[model samples]
Target chain A: MRAACHAPIRGDFTGLRGLEWDKMLHCPAQAARAIPTISAATSMSQTRHVFFISDGTGITAETLGHSLLAQFPDTRFRNHRLPFIDSTDKARDCVQRIKDAAIESGIRPIVFNTLVDPSAVAALREADALFLDLFEKFIEPLENELGQRSTHAAGRFHGIADSQDYKKRIEAINFTLAHDDGVSHADLAEADVILVGVSRSGKTPTSLYLAMQFGIKAANYPLIPEDFERNRLPVELTRYRGKLFGLTIGPDRLSQIRQERRPNSRYASLENCLHEIESAQRMMKREGIKWLDSTAKSIEEISTIILQEVRLDPQSY
Target chain B: MRAACHAPIRGDFTGLRGLEWDKMLHCPAQAARAIPTISAATSMSQTRHVFFISDGTGITAETLGHSLLAQFPDTRFRNHRLPFIDSTDKARDCVQRIKDAAIESGIRPIVFNTLVDPSAVAALREADALFLDLFEKFIEPLENELGQRSTHAAGRFHGIADSQDYKKRIEAINFTLAHDDGVSHADLAEADVILVGVSRSGKTPTSLYLAMQFGIKAANYPLIPEDFERNRLPVELTRYRGKLFGLTIGPDRLSQIRQERRPNSRYASLENCLHEIESAQRMMKREGIKWLDSTAKSIEEISTIILQEVRLDPQSY
Candidate 1:
């Protein structure tokens, strides 16, 4: 990886110096426009580079970095993850790579470091970039607040506390997978929440998200035309009224979403969508079930709201 | 929420004052051991309270805070998330809750904040707690590195970007869902990667993660007894050789995992697991297919290694 980065910098810089200073700046931009790969090596504004450096799996760094970067949608970034940078040698090599990237791109890369070792962190600080140390910024304050010093351990963030947590999450996943689309009636009562909605109304994703993120057993049952026509909850769900959460979408949006799956069908028609949604909404209201319009909500927002309303904590089993 | 917090504080603190000074502190610890919920309210050493405060979905704060807290596994935390604190009044309410928590618990709380607006952030800072602001700590350095100011806009982190990104992810998900278990051979060629594995070998979660996180269209096909008996790749998979990635598991682990799903069946038998794994490994090696043992890895780890090995960038379409 180091050789790959350095190889491009040495070759590019030598060729860059042969041209006049003014042309040197302009030539790369023109070449970059013509060739997409050259954009990272030429224009700083054209590409923003981000490196998530961690001593473990780098998932946490990537998750936090991605969330932060998502706020800047106008900025385009090329991302890289360097996980298991625990030693001083690896940290030094990482710094060199960042510097080489800076030399080649005329852009300093942003480094999100979760490196806990002081020496390794210091080595990375020498790089020609913005080094944001996640631990350094918060650890001391946390220690003082808690009246305890941190262990500064690596990989603990992802280490299975016991087989229990792993088992719980997997069981939730398996339950969510099995109970999907009301496939199994036996486990309906076991679900923390039963999500009801029209087809493609974001039930599958939301159920999976709830199970995966919060260890909540979420079972989703689609409200079909039969149930809509009857204007009643499914017989199996009538017993678990307290666990039911309803999801509805705008009729036009539902039509558009369904049309993509099966075009020109009655199932994907706007009339069907309106009828199903109206019937489902009426049923939910009559039963005093809280519901959300999922047409404009992201899965995260929808899941968060549901979790809050249900009083489920992500940490609790 | 405000009423809930203040009600507890008013009830708990006065009772705490009536006890002897040293016993007031020690009594809570004793009470905490007897009562788990009291651990959050009484003993500082017995339990740590953490607040992930954000002006958005709070995913970033929860993720980073969880990672940091994971290091101190010995310390138990009672966590609360306060999202969408977009106004000063909301911020003030948040501070009041934090202050009340401190009064009730007899310990200061640790706050992980992602507040962007200056006034809202300042209001949160006034609370008697350890305030670790993610944006405040890293944004200025990022600005210096990029030679530009940040927009600090709320909701952009998760806002739908011209519907293109949302569409691509959803399409990938739909494709993955459709192509799951080799349900549709017609679109096999459209997949960016195809996962071949045995039953319950972590294929479903891995495929979903790749599609949802990286926007990679992944299809998974199970390696069955037929493929094992023949000691060859499936005929349907031969055409998309370059896109094939294999997942294997330790026989014992596989048996244990499968036993939970279908106890005492041939599918969950140790003999069946050994035969399947041995045959699959031999076939994968003979076919020059890259594979990984998923027995000891999480879905995140499995998906990440696959993405890295294939050199797929999540940022790209």
Candidate 2:
């Protein structure tokens, strides 16, 4: 059976609701042959039903398909997508077709409409077929899953605003970094972007993403206790204020991340993590360092926000 | 008009195609109005026709949606998702309904599909609409573009797979390298993850991606001439070989990345860059280190592959 799941609400199946593929039957087709398969009662050899529905896009559908196939590894996922829908009529029509197809095919597969009209959702629920809500279930929860952020930094923004020249920024950051490998403080003046974060606020990933993806040079430094002891944004940052940006995460999140590494170090202690976050944020505000609250955001989101915020357009590469 | 151009497959919007309310386009009612703003001529109103599309759930799509909305600075995105469709038939049907509705609404907006589906792609193209093929245009290119790969050094297999844990590996490498302000190399062992890359291979952003998204402690280091000259990984890496990973880029890409920085540095010279890459690759092979080619691959793809290769399942988060 070509059973499928989709997310119309959120791209990448992040918002897909219910039916954790992990827990789904791995070999639905094979399972059917087994005495206890979900559809074993039906004696239809041609009982192949493909159901596609999403809260958003088909990403989760694809992912879910993979898991379902894992249960039934022999299944093939035929790609499909429906741009966000805005009306209930289409959704209603879709539900009716799905319900009918399920009965006819004897597969009883579920369909996901990522952005079906709420009325459409009502229609599906009323159809007596299992329907997964990609929005309320999956997407929302993933977004709220707070993870520790990194401190990797990208090169300062490069690219001539007119030319979109990011190449130079990447090279400069690379050269500056290479030439001054052990000289972190020496090249502060050459940086297009420098990251400052309390412990690990996701500086490194953003920096690497910028360089690798956008061809921007990015540098990052942790806000160690010593920096706070001195009560400054790294004395070197004073020389290049425009290029500096700060990243901060919620104290609770920070502590959890630390605990993962050190387990029980004083620094990894929740209280310590909270103290560090509070201190770093205050320092950033006082130092007039433009910063981002990265606690709730994904790396991609954080990178975009920082890049847009810095507005550092470099040219020359 | 909402003008979006896909680089790979030429975009010819002869007319409106369809809209899928995705995760970002949370309000279907709002998305109904938003899709047309891009195509709206003089008819201006408060309605936003922004939409987000995903296969299963709004998970990843929601992130992109939020970022896009944030990009407009002043503009708003009314996001929605089209639910459930996994085959060409459903895609076509959904697209047809969307095209009809878009015309009535006067919003001819671009559709972004994260999941790559040739059939749906063909249908979307046939509809004379703007489509964003995330994998085709955005993702696959990263793999070919990376041109270089990273090496597994410090944690376990070498250092990447060791039972010593992540932080210690990072700190060991860091401690080996000298830093000012009492930032002891001894503390380098604390890094949850470490990224090593040739200049311009995009270490910064990848590090940040992990840190920000996964809250993994990360550190990044550059692969320099002396290390290459000796055909060995950095000395600091010896202590934590399992935790170490390398990133490399193509010579041409390196040149482009470098020229942007120093414009004329000998290191950025194509000849030098090529030599550096060859040496790095040879050394990695000799060291029996595992690595990923960074050329042509975007940070997201690279991160995905490496995280998976490293057995760090992103799904856990």
Candidate 3:
């Protein structure tokens, strides 16, 4: 089956309703194939050199490349990123590197490029590899649809062109940094959203992703043992109850994550994880707050769900 | 002019050249168009609601929206994001919210959606807005080209399917957090690349971006005042000279940035910024280190250039 198989909304798929923590971990595909694979060739596939080359941040190329590569699970990949190759000479150097990688791996490297400059793109095309030019593939179709030619820009996708947008993102990032880990609740009023969770519950990364990607001032507060013991929301968070979003993790997963941070301690114990998660969920339910599980989800999934729930303005940072 | 106009590599365009600090700030676009506009419509435009509705992170929708909106700078946009709308009921709520936005603003809102679920997409189509379904627009053409039907997956784009890739990214992020700001250089050899820059030269954000986006275990070390006085590379960095990539900024811009952090102090003074930048540049030149200016660049640009220069394996992290 393709990796892009649709994960049916099996658990608490209710829209805008209370997103259950446990129900969110349901993976339909995993249930269909519960047994581990015993294929020997899966481990012996030739390691191919995959390159995500771009003329900007290389983020789009990486994202697209990863999505495509995820389809072939048996193929072993060694990825090398080549970003901001705008000049012809840099492109030539990139070609040399690709050739070297191909020689070292004894297999032709796969190149995924979004180069805007024709000269640079041409130089890399000469390399011995299965070259995939994303811009070359889609720009023509888009131009035909829009009835206008593309600018062939290099840095505009994620560049600092609009100072206003740049300032908003920077301000949001700084705000997130300042409000991280319940560091300060004095300026909670300024926050667009406040995330509450126990330690190692994917709060920090989710908060940063929301700030960086959507320009939302996301402030995260850790629900410590004291907060769980009190059996109530903190006084600072009481005023911003409407902006509160909760994150919970499975006890097993939470225990493993905490063990990495603080090994052989009460905090890392499975019992402690279960206790904290149960208390946090009870408090969240009592206070009428929506929650989601972070154990089976990525930071992108968590942040996207939060944004959908709150309906915050993405461009109003 | 669209903000997507290609930035011609005018100043110091040579590939991997000296990369002079002051020369990097020469933005030709700014030169061609200077001074704030006295146009009154810029501030008085009617505010319009924009929504990037998706079943994923809404990143692609946001990118397309921003690029399209850049062509019409006079339009004041208030963007709200609605992601992970996988059910028909949630789609109804989204339509209601869109209608409410139109009612409040007295203008039909603009909605850019990439909804994968057909039922959800249908419900959203009933909303009173300029609905642009990016998926519906291009999916058929892509299907025809590939001779295969798309999975119509909702979460596959950003889902946690490949546990290995997810683990590598999380590990890289952990490594970056542990090694931030020269906190611990004990495991510096494990880093794919090490960034060296003076204070506030955009090291932390760039380091985090590299780690999170490309799965590169990036470590950054700040060039302190004593190092500048000594006029030599730090002892800890000398061992990883080949892994070193320097970041420099224009003195005036550096002073302005510093002033924001420590207002009205010697650290933010123009003289101090100039001295540090000059000394840092001289030291970098003497050591034959390749550097880029962060004065007018974004973290994305800085990180992209570093990746291109170092050619680190993105998947090895």
Candidate 4:
């Protein structure tokens, strides 16, 4: 007899709902027999099925859920996202799925939900799992504090509530895209903030994040060797001194990032990265442009800092 | 006498900190005299100050806080974000800022925080505000449920904890960028999902969202008028039927989106939008490819559906 395989089968729950626990746990007999070492590869960590259910996109529940779960690094969570659970029928389906996950894992599943509809919330609460209703816990307190009744809207949080705001965000994304890596100088004046950095110091992704998340038109320009030789800011950027923000990276990290893009090239050399970053920093200092080190920072962190430092007028963009 | 200006002064706290409340509330004398009608534009809505504080990016705090605050549509919130508050000194500064806002608004501020460090949390709790520490409420319950102590780590949620995962996300962003709007066919085989849609049907933003948030390499191709005329799926996408996901929008919404790009043109006409969407949907139906209506759905909703329907193997990507 082949040894039992402990790794959970990862896929959609629809096909696995009716399967027996033994069948779900075991690999195919032929494959298990062929790979006798499979049983030895079993993970020692505890496994728990986790679900993020919401009336809208479920992004909030998932984001907060992930943050909470990150604290418990010892356990492995088999994650599932059930988004757009607007109707009672969908809520019922979600409950059933949660129950199935509990049965399959032989552990009560942990669910984080942001359903606002009372009926839908009540329906999902019937599942035999640790249901953490995110909205239910705070809505009443908020209502009392605000001295008004909440709309209790299902999809309002992520919905396009304000058409003007939505349009501005879309425009920002387009502006960011058009100005990416100094591709176009036609509308440098329109940029809410312009990022200048050595290539791969993390300007592109940061710019995109600023636009996508905050509706800020961010443009980025690369500080190449020619700029360093000239020891001056780009002519296109000189006029927009107030909008300019610089990004610098550690030489080692810059080289490591570039190494993946262009292996065994002069551009990926540590010496080159060092010289470029130093030159960029010196120029930024001389020009009185604010800058940040993006060595270990996430794009969100970098964007947040830029927003704080740049202090762009929200109404202007 | 000039009626008091009601709009909250929006700018950096450093400049506003020591200013008298009257000076902060009222517009400049010259401007107020010139624009005498400003008093007529005073908003009657209740105003409150809101703050999101965290040891990391504070994005999770802001996201959840926004969701909660959206319930109260009647109140205007003067929002502030104090991110990367990992030290007691920073937390003290944050508390001071909150107090300043409270004084300026003549109402206690509402603070949402996700600080993990005990010293920082304690320091921030000193503010004369309704402090809602997000982590404090959830961490204990989670700890009890998991039967393990949390690591109590600051900045772990958004930091580069797993370098491999971070690298994959960066690669995904690059891949999505290169493959955006069918700009490159060099790595079509590597895309985790290919989105097919008519122009301005929300393919690019959705693709970028999938890449940025979920670390999925998503490529998008617009089903142009030529594709509708040919009445067929694009030849390049035919081989990857399983990876294809289509996005269809209401003709009116599509036309409006296109109008923003090219105003008063045939491309932005409702008739053209309808024909392109119908043909694309028909082709997708014939090919048995899954798709969604992007008319009112946010990019997060669309991407979640695609991830669910496509069910790509995590290991394969």
Best by lDDT: 4
**lDDT for model 1, on a 0 to 1 scale?**
0.71
Candidate 4 — which residues are off by over 4 angstroms? A1-45, A313-317, B1-45, B312-317
Share of real interface contacts recovered by each model? 0.24, 0.00, 0.13, 0.35
Worst 10 residues of 4 chain A by lDDT: A15-24
**Residues A156-254 of candidate 2: C-alpha lDDT, one tens digit per residue:** 111122223333433543533342322367656666688888776767645654554345667777788887787777776677777777788878878
Q: Which of the two candidates, 1 or 4, achieves a greater lDDT against the reference? A: 4
Question: Which ranges of candidate 2 are over 4 A from the true structure?
Answer: A1-317, B1-297, B300-317
DockQ of predicted model 4: 0.26
TM-score of 4: 0.86
CAPRI band for model 4: acceptable
Which model is ahead, 1 or 3, in terms of TM-score?
Answer: 1
- Rank list by lDDT: 4, 1, 3, 2
Report how large a share of the reference interface contacts model 4 reproduces.
Answer: 0.35
Native-interface RMSD of candidate 4: 10.1
Error of 2 at B24 (Å): 19
All candidates: DockQ: 0.20, 0.03, 0.10, 0.26
Residue-pair clashes per prediction, in order, are 0, 189, 1, 0
lDDT of 1 by residue, A234-273 (tens): 8899998778888888899999999988999999999988
How accurate locally, in lDDT, is each candidate?
A: 0.71, 0.46, 0.68, 0.74
